[model samples]
Every structure is written in C-alpha cells, then in structure tokens.
Target: MPEPARDPRLKSLINQLQPGPVRKVKVIGFDGVDVLVQLMDAEGEEAEIGRIPLYEASMRRMDNPSELFELGQEISAEEIGRWREGQLHLSARACEIPALRSFLLSIERRQIVTGTVSEVHNFGVFVHLDGEPDGLCTGFIRVPDLTWTRMNHPSEVVAPGHRITAEVIIAETRSGQVTLSLKALREDPLIRFADQIGRVLTGPITKIIPFGVFVQLAPGVEGFLHLSELTDEPGETSDRLVDEGELITVRVAEVDLQRHRVRLCAADGEGGF
Candidate 1:
C-alpha cells in the first residue's frame, strides 16, 4: 500500500498566522509568477520562518512579477489561504483592506467622491479614492454612466490615472462595491434634443431591425423610424427601403419624455438612401 500524501511541516507553522494583513515580509525573489518573501517575527527585527509565496501579487493582471515587486522591498498583503502542498496565497487588491472597506461603506449615496482612475475597461472604470482610503480602489463607473455621449467605449471619456469626480449611486459594503456615475454630474442632452419635435433631421441609419430603423438624430439621441412610417406601401420591411449607414431625412413625430424616446417618420420623399 502507498503511504498517504503527507502535509508539509510548514503547514502547521503557517496555520498559526491568521488570514489578514501580513505585517512583516521582505521580498527576496520571484518564482516566475509569484513573489517569494520571508515572513518576519512580530518584533519586525528577525526572520520568523520559511519563505512564503505571494501569488499574482496584484488585482490587475501583470505581465512581469518585477512590475509589482522588487528585491529586499517590504510590503503588506492580506493572507487569503494556507499552503496545501506548499502553496500559500495572498491578495493585494485595494478592496480587501479593512479600513478601506469601512470608509467606502460610510460614503453617502449621491455624494460626490473624488478619485483617480486606476483602470478602464469596455464595461466600466475603476477608481482609486483619495484621503483616508488611498491606494484601494473600491469604486466603479459603468459604461453608460461614464458620459452623456453615446460612446462605443469608456476609454473615450477617461483613462487610467485620470482624475474624476463621480456621484455615488450605491454603496454595498458586504460586496465591497461603490458604484459611481460621471453623467450624473452633467445635464441630460436628451432634454435639449426634445425641443426639435416636428423638425426634419438627417443622420445615417445606425441600426436596422424587422420592426423599424434607428436614426441618430444627435449624439446620444436616436429616433425610431417604424416600418409603417417608412413608405406608402403598407406591408414592407424596413430594410427594403434603407440600409445601415445610408443618410436619410426624417421628421420627429413625437418626443416621449416619460419614456425618453423620440419617434420619427420619413420626411417628404426622403425615406431611403
């Protein structure tokens, strides 16, 4: 019979160190993807035990471990898990810090918070707040809230390390989410566009569907050109007349402020092309 896989002696020693902030660790080397460091005793003066691994070492994906850590540099991390077969893990994300979490939760809804953009994705932007909770970015700005303009991406409005002020939309302490909105700081462009009712507007066909075509009347403002209104022919699909990116003129039939929609119809002899 084969002997049972034995737990290393280091497991017991690591079990004694509770999961949280690791107070004293001197970065010694990098094992390809992880930062190898030595844990020091409480006095912060003497080496306590064997070397431990700081996995990933950052919340954001990094190409090189050296970008995050250097030799002989002292740093702190939240101990997340113990070694199973010699694999200790730590997390360096800003959201995992206790003081940072507390400060984020205390922020009131609709209150403006100042932060520097840490990362920008197609979906949203992450912000690292200033003042007491520095370095820990717990806030997020979704794509729609990034701007009043209808942009294809968030990078158009903000970039990494860009200073921004956003209104807190929600503060969920348990999940460590502080949702923010940059558009909340500005007036809605739709309100101004609403004044153009009954006027002829021309724009390239942005999207086409079986029911209707969508025309960009203005930036962030679109009007639906229903099939029934596209041509004199009663039973026709919208695509029969206009293709996408073809400029056409349409009259704004109605502006539904409650629904925030603009209904449009082809202007005299201007349905297609």
Candidate 2:
C-alpha cells in the first residue's frame, strides 16, 4: 500500500524544528498555560516574541510554569517551530539539560545505540541510555518493538540492568526521548515463513480471542484461523469446536508481510482447525 502524503505545513514544521538550534530567551510573563518570552539576540538584546507552552517548560512534570521560570529570568531554549498563528514556539525542556539536548541531537534514525535496561513494564521498557545526561532515562522500547515474536510479558525478553543494543526508531527532542527497537536488529520470522504458504501443517492452538484462535506453526510464527473457518456449520463458535493446546491441521492461506499476519484455513477433510 502507498504511504499517505504528509501535510505540507506539518512537513515544513518538522523540517524547521528537527536539528533545531538552541536560543536565549527571557521570560516576560505567563499567559494561562503559556510562558511569554522575548527572544534574545547574540548581544543579549530582545528580538522577537516567543511562547513556551507549559508542557515545554521543563522535562519534569509541574503544575505551573512559575515552578521553573521567574519573570525576566534569562534561560536557554530551542526554537521548535511556530504555532498556526505565527507565534514562535520554544521548548525549554529540550535545552534544560545541555547534555540531553546534545545527546538527542547526536543520534539518528536506524543508528545503533546501547543502553542498560532500567525498568520493564507491561507497556514498555525504559533504558538509561549510555551517553544520556546524568539522572535521565531517555531510551524506551514499546512492547511491540521489543521483539518480533509473541510474548506474554517484556520480562521474558529483558530484565533490569541488562545491557542491550537497539536501532533508534526516533530521537524526539520534544519528548526528551529516544525510541529504540530491539527487533529491528533481528530477522522477521514472518518473512521466512512466507515461502511456506499453501503447505499443510499441524500445530497447537495457542490462544483463542473473540475473532479466532492463533495456531503456532513454528516458534514465533503463528497463523490466525478465523472463527468462520473453524467449521462449515453456521452458528458454531470457536470455543465449542476447539480448545487451547489442541493440535489441529491447517493450510497456510496467506501471509501478509507488511502487516506481519498469517491467515489459516482448516485442512482438507478436517471439520475445524
């Protein structure tokens, strides 16, 4: 499938913001959720007006902009593109820690980065990137990006304090984060299994969702047998026809490489699989 075109304005904004340069700005005042500021030139003279949204004020969460900045306080921030109204937008969080900004700017997409796993949660894994600023954990691997294989939990693949190398998916200065992917370094199992389409295979039912059951054809390779494919008889639910761990014969119907999905159908002479 063709990729969607990006909005011209957004594309322009990204091009302008990425690899952005840090600038000096003095807080003029607070406007509700925004911090009004005056851009400072090299000579420390005020130039243009800039605004820092509350969320961009600091890397740490805070209830108010006043928590970090005071009136007329000179601070450093990166020019993060302009709002729709042409108001200059700045990110204090991006430059709040000089080391972090340098680290985020130095990394590139698909670059190999090493880090120590600091936490493992159901949603993702957090890492203390090797070159990141002190006391900051910037590397993160989302659950799906951890590996290509199906897993019950992230702990199955990595534990706290484990050193790992991953490919950088993105280095977002706005979020002060580097999204890493361990599976990008490994071969996709589905790509290897694609050649096996149309072959008859017998495997155990690993899981049964509302739509169908997942049959493990190979380690890390599972095929989805839709509930409708379970039996020719209408009104027969999957639970009534099959049980988890039950070996069932199926034919590989399709393998979607882009989507990383495998479709299966019951083998000939089999009522359900």
Candidate 3:
C-alpha cells in the first residue's frame, strides 16, 4: 500500500482538510470489511450512503465491525474522501475522541512538536504531546527515528517522563497518531565520513553476521566488510576469520549517504590468507 503521507491524494486532502461538523450516520449493514451506513441530515432523516472501511472503523483493533456497531446504531464519523466506488469514505476513528481529529489536522510536516515520553516499547516510543486534548497520547517515534546511532533498546535513548522535541513525520487521523522523529533534528554522523572513502582505517569488529562483519571506524560510524573480503580462500566463514572486538584494517570501498551504509575491503598491504 502507498504510504498515506506520500500519497498525493492524501496531500491534497490535508491541504483543504478541516475538522468537525462531523456527520451523523446510521449503520445499515456490513459489506465484507466495510460497514455500510446511511448519512443523516439535521432532521435525522437518512440521505445518501457512506462506507467505513475496516481500518477506519476504530482506533483500537477489532476482528469485526459488528464488535463496535449494531444494526440501526447511530454514530458520528468524519468524511475523509469518497472511495473509488463513489460512496463517501468515512473515518469512525477520527470522531472517536472529541477534538482529536482537529489536533491532528493542525500538525504539518516537519513541524516541531514537544512531548513527554509515555512508554518505551521495543518497536517504538509513545509520547503524550503537549497541547493535545486531555487523555490523548498521540505522538510516536519508531525505533529508527529515535537516533542515528545503533542502540540495543529505546531505553538507552529515552525513558518514561523524559521530555523531548521531535519533528513531525506525519499526522495520521486514520490512526490517530503523529509520527515523530528525534533523529531528524540531529546531523547524520555518516556525513563527515563521506569524504573519507578509500582511506585505510583500523577498527575493532563490532559485530559478525553470516555474510559479513561490521567494523566501527568512529563513534556511531560503522562499515560492512563482506566475508569474501575477509579471506582470499573460498568457503571461509566470517566468524572463523575475525572475532568480535578484534581490530582489523580495512579500506573504505563505498559510502552510501542515502542508505546510511558503508562498504569496506581488505587493506591494500594486508592480504587475508
């Protein structure tokens, strides 16, 4: 699926999107993963039909739409856009909490937001953003967005109650989340090393994998040395040739700034026999 943030359709929606005067709809039936509803006017009279896709049904996970709504149940939903079928696509999640949709709509890309860390999970960190409606924790930082350097866990960078400032990646009303990035505020450590390609440097092996080993040339800067470069002899495994923390000399073969990766080869004077 195309990322909503990068989708041109979504961009156009964001530019003109406004919150509220939420629509009132009455559940009519279910069509597979979609919940069919009848749009209601001020008089509560039924008008045209609308749809709430499974993903837009709720902010919380549910196996089926019936779990949240019943036949003839009246609910509030925001009209996001019309589906390809010509029926209006609505977001029940956006209207779940009052003012949440408005708060998310207020955030723009690259805008800095401040928040306090609420939870640190292996996958990401949840934050309670400042100025958000009470009881709403809308900020989130994925593991890669936490920092530029390698880390075993998010706790190494932030803990609960720690105040932090981050750039907004996206404000998703469908998910009721504001994707944030702390590393976006910091300079990439690999930028300085981009000019050092082809220079021979000695560093301890930081990690060894089945296909290659990683060498740390500087703080937070590491390069990959493929197993083939570790030995001229075929069939030699990486771990058999180098141990973790063992210092080895390697020449920078390539620096990929876009991907944040470095390629290394055996030093000119040193042959892996």
Candidate 4:
C-alpha cells in the first residue's frame, strides 16, 4: 500500500492502524510465534472483531517493529521486512490480498475491553483506548451496585485516570454509545444464598432502619433481619441485636429471585412468622 492519506470512505470507523503484539505459534512463517490484538470501541472496549494474526498484520504495516510501543498503534515498513526475513513472506505469495483482507474486514464495535479511565463525565466516562479511538463511555453504576454505602461521588469508586474492567452490555454502532455493568458480572446474591438455604450460616449487620436491620449474608448480598424476628425486648434498639459486622447464625427464610431479595432469621428455624 502507498503512503496514502486517510480515505474519506473509511473516516467513520478507521482508527489509525498501529503496531500489534507478537507470540509463538506453529505457523509455517514466523518463529513459531504469533501476536494477538484487539479492535477497540469508544469506551476502550475490545470490538468482537479484529485481525486474524495481529502480529503478522502489524509487522507488515509497521516499518520499525522495535519502535511499536503498544498494541493498536500505527505500523511502519521496516517491521514488514523483518517478518519477510523470518520466512513469513506475504509479499512473495501469489495471493496476498486474501490473507490481509481478513484483518481489515473483522473490525467490530461490541466487546469488553480494559483501559485507563481518562475522565469521568456526569453521565459517562472517556478513556484513551490507545490511538485507535478515543470516545465517551456512558451509563450509570446503578444504586444497588454502588458497593460502598458511604454515599459516594462517582469519582470515589473510580477515580479519573484509573483503570477499570467493565462489560460491554450495550453497544449500538449506529449511535456510538454503550452501557456498562459491574453488577451483571456478579452472581445474583439471592440465587447464591438460596442454594445455602438448608445450611446454617452467619450474617452481619449492614444497616439499621426503623423497619429492620440489613445484614450481609455475603459480599454484595444482603438479607432483611426484621425487628420482629429479633429475639430482643420491646423498644430495644435494633442495633443492640444487630450491629454492623456483628455475626449471628441465621436460617434462610426465603429467597425471592425476581427481586433479588433474601430473608433470614435465627438458624434454629423456629420463628413463628
């Protein structure tokens, strides 16, 4: 390919092609090694599609293989020569275009990827996913998924310039927007605890309210320890029976999968309710 200017037709999806990785594989060419790379989305996510043999493609594009600092970077001509010297000569083949076509055709817009968070906006985030594409990653972290009950600012859980791993739950190329979820990756607490219904376990007080005490049966999972179930005297502070991190054996009373709710009581399974 000539040192050409950007194509007006590809302006929509072409991220500046860059150097990729190298590894050991058993192909006739190369040192029995190969490289893997990803096509990234705006949120610094891996698009489901990308080059088949990223190393070879990258080497062919990059003139200076040693100068390629990271994956998803632009390539040069010298690197291509190195690949040829290593017995992987695409230029010598009669049908070079077919092999190269696979890499260019597999570009994708939906997939999970990891990146250093560049900035946090009121509604979303922006991460510099190398040089390929720098776009906004929008959506909320949901109330129940906050993980910290300290009434935090979005910056607290994930600071500006911090690296976060998120799932690509929503990716519509037509809009260039995406939604991520930390909770989706999590096992539904109710479902997990429900499996332990017949087993005795302990819960620790997480929060106290007029109606009940919220006790944690497991991390990111909670159960209602109602005041009525407490073996305490009338008017006694709910905190007395259940304080934060105070463990008490409890039997699983109910598991509501729809609501992701769990109800617990004394492990003896004798509560009248």
Candidate 5:
C-alpha cells in the first residue's frame, strides 16, 4: 500500500505555530488528573500539543480530573510559556467561561430550579443546579432559605445528595452567584397565625433574647413576649422569668403580618394581659 500525502494546510499550520497561548484544544490523553490535548491551529488543524496538570484542570476541588473531562473533549486553554523539553504547560481552569454566570442571570427571579444538594455548610447549602453543565456549581441556599422554621444548621433540612426544588432569590451575574430559596415556595406560617390573635395559646419558650422571649406557638410560628410584657419588675432579666423549653401560657396580643411579627403577653401571671 502506498502512503497518502499529508495536507499542505496542516503542515503549514504546524510549522507556523510556536508554544505560547494555544486555544481550542481537544483532550487526546489523560493520566490521573493530567490531560494531554491535540492543539488546533487558527485553521482548526490538530497538532500534538501539551498537558493540563491536575491542579490546572478546574477551579473546584478535583480529586480526579478525568472524572469530569474525558478524551476528545474540546476545551479552551492558555499555554503558560513553554518547557525547555519542548512542551506547553496549559491551564484548563482558565477556560472556565462565564456561561454559568450568563445562564444564572437569564434565570428569572422566583424561577423554580431543581438541584442536587452538593454540600451542606454551616451557613448554607450548596446546590448543583440541575440541567447545568457538570461541575458548574454556583447555586447557594442560605440557612434562612433552607426552611420556613428556625434551623440551627442547614443539615436539619437538607443533606448532601438530597434533591431539592428552590426558587431563584438572587442572580448576581457580575459575581457569578445564584442564591436560591426553598422556603419561598411555601406559605409563611406567620401569616396563617394571624387568625390566632387574641387567643390564649400555650407553648414552650424557644429562645430568650435580651429584648424578648420567643414562644413557639406552632411550627414556624413564634410570638415575641417583650421583656416589658414578661413582668412588671422594674429591672429583671427575661432569663429570670422564662427558660427555653419551659411551657408558658400567653395571650396573642397582636399579629403583625406585614412584619411577620407577633406580640404576646402573660395569660395569668403578674404581667397578665
């Protein structure tokens, strides 16, 4: 069999190219987290190029880059100068474009989005938005958005790998952040508690702040008993009269639906309403 002649265009591209900042490379090889790519010239001709080190494959914590990128995957990258041995040191992470940012911004406020719980942090939950490109995680649900009721930790409402539906609360395109809220999908219990106004409700004191005692009338529904309403004592701390988890009788004095606040007074004690 006779050998076929090479394309003159491909030879010309290869001869004209020098390792500096190659773009639009295709993954031709992989080792651990490192990747070897076939660099494409301006004319889209492929030439043996360089490797992207594990550290340069992604911005996120990557145990194995191959898990995310596969052979023949086309990715843009920058060639960080050249090695003395005639190889290009590439950075694939730099190729992480703003596609996610633009997509998040295009998402309307209050738009429902489903995502898998990727991480549960002390302050919030990190969700990997569904339908988005893999490894593009920027969706966050703050602790307040995890549930309607008070939560000490995000894990109380969501665990890692839990699939959840949430509303887009804020889409910050500039910062490439999407804030989500699961609670927004539900009705506020405080609003429903309005009908309980002027009724005597017995519940446990959940918290005692300097300003008042929070009495849980129902799940996600709490009434504040201001320090002034707890006792007639001139200068007594709320802790002196109430303790968390202590059952108490209170008359719902007022329900401020607009502020999502409820005021309560002792039902029969010295501070009885």
Candidate 6:
C-alpha cells in the first residue's frame, strides 16, 4: 500500500530522526516552547524522546519546562478543539465549489445590477452586490470608464454606497475578479454631440496660456485652439488674443474619441481652418 502523503513540517522531522513506534513527544526550554515529537515504541519503559537541542533554544523564554510539558499534554485537547472549529471554516470555504458554478447565477449580459459602490480608487471603482458575501460581487471601475469628463480624482465619479449599474466587462473564474464599466451603463453624450463637430460650438474659455485656450466642448472633451491657430486682428499678438471665460467660437476641426481630444480652428472661419 502507498504511504499517506505527509506535511513538509512533519516530513522534515521524520527524515531527521526515524519514528521508532509512533509516540507523540513535546519538550520545553528557555526562549519559548515547542513540540518535540516522534512515533515511539511502547514495548519497553518508554524512553524519553531524543531532543533537537537547537530546537529547544526557542523555548528559552518558557523558563519552565514543566509548564510546556503541561501544555504539550494538553495538545491533544487544544489541537482537537481548534481543529473542530477549523473544520467548520474549511467546510465553508470548500463548500463553495466555484468550478461547478456558472458565471452568472441567472442574469443576462448587460443586465443592470444596482450594487453599492465600494473602495473608489484613483483609477477604478469597486462595486459590491447587495446582501451577498462581501467577497462575492465587488468589482473594479476604471476612472476613465466612469464618465465623459476629465477626472482629477475618482471620488468625483463614485462614492461608497452609491448605487450604480455597471456593465460586467468580464466575469471569469481565472481572476474571479469582475471588471465593471459605468460608462457603458450610461448614455454617451459624445454620440449626441457629434453633430456639433462641423458646426462651431462656443463655450467659456476655461483655460488659457501661451499654448492655447481650452474650451469645454463637452463635459469631458475639450478643444485646443492653438496660439498659431488663433487669427490675428490687425497687429494683435497671440498673447493679447484670448482670455479664459471669454466666449470663443472655435470650429471643431477634428473629433478624436480615441485620444479623447478635439482639434479646433478660430471662429472667423479664417487661419486656414
């Protein structure tokens, strides 16, 4: 018959000194206390188990070997009780046979789940399904995927306890980690605002510098009306050109969804738009 597999900790001890007759041994010394055990024969006056002197150094703090011997004697009692409690925990974790379970308990793709937002991060939002194990339905929502607006921080888009319907981008066992998409759950303004591209859309110049003016084209999307792109009025230098919050009607020259930026031309319909 094949021998039962052994824990490495037990194996190491067995390899060092052969088990003579399978008797459990425990020893104590100064540093602290530990178990010194072996399978010993009961045939004779059971000889004291051999000591790994170095191993006993850890028991130096124990100061009383008799006390540790008392503790060792109680091992059969304490270990058994602990194992009984551990058995419940083990069964609970093991009973969840994920391999036999389906990804969706019973939901369609794109189905909205009103889950509470949790652990909002600079890059992602985590959501937890209601009433399930805390480990069950919590997932991530990347900052970029949260809204159409440029996010200086993730907290702006999500907060703990915020009920949100995030699309399940991935629900696989490999990671067992869910990838959520809040943007997919919401209506896209870009799609509706796409028509404003050919026509000039004017908004406050929220930012201005030597580079150009950043006009809010949409909540998130903005156009850079370059210093060179601004038409000069008579001898007006580019520096004297535009101030922030000044109404600017720059033609949306290009709409770049991939880069999340827009190209613009001066409102005068000139400057080689």
Strongest candidate by TM-score: 2
Question: Candidates' lDDT values, in order?
Answer: 0.71, 0.86, 0.86, 0.46, 0.75, 0.53
| Per-residue lDDT of candidate 6, residues 224-248 (tens digit) | 7877677544554445777777877
TM-score for each model: 0.56, 0.87, 0.82, 0.45, 0.61, 0.52
Q: Give the per-residue lDDT digits (tens) of candidate 2, residues 211-260.
A: 68999999889999988778677777778888999998899999887678
Q: What lDDT score is found at residue 150 in candidate 4?
A: 32
lDDT of 5 at 107: 80
With a 3 Å backbone cut-off (N, CA, C), the pairs that clash in candidate 3 are: none
Quote the positional error of residue 135 for candidate 1 in Å.
4.9
Q: How well is each residue in 75-102 modelled by candidate 4, as lDDT tens digits?
A: 2211122333343221111112333323
How far residue 103's Cα lies from its native spot in candidate 4, in Å, is 18
The TM-score of predicted model 2 comes to: 0.87
C-alpha root-mean-square deviation, each candidate = 14.5, 4.0, 5.2, 19.2, 17.1, 17.2
User: What is model 6's C-alpha RMSD?
Assistant: 17.2
Error of 5 at 27 (Å): 31
Q: Which portions of model 3 show Cα errors greater than 4 Å? A: 1-26, 39-48, 60-76, 79-88, 269-273
Model 2 pairs whose backbones collide:
none
lDDT of each residue in 48-159, candidate 3, tens digit only: 9999999889987899999989999999998887767788989898888769877998998899999999999999999999999898899999998999888889999999
lDDT tens digits, residue span 1-273, model 5: 222244577456433332234378999888666888888988999876788888778777768888878888898876764664988878776556557634754687678999899999898888888766566787899886677677678888989899889998666432346788898788777766777878888999999887688899998888889887776777788887778999988888887764567888777534623
Better of 4 and 6 by TM-score: 6
Which residues of candidate 5, in runs, are more than 4 Å off?
1-96, 268-273
In model 4, the Cα lDDT at residue 57 comes to 39
- Comparison by lDDT, 1 against 3, better one: 3
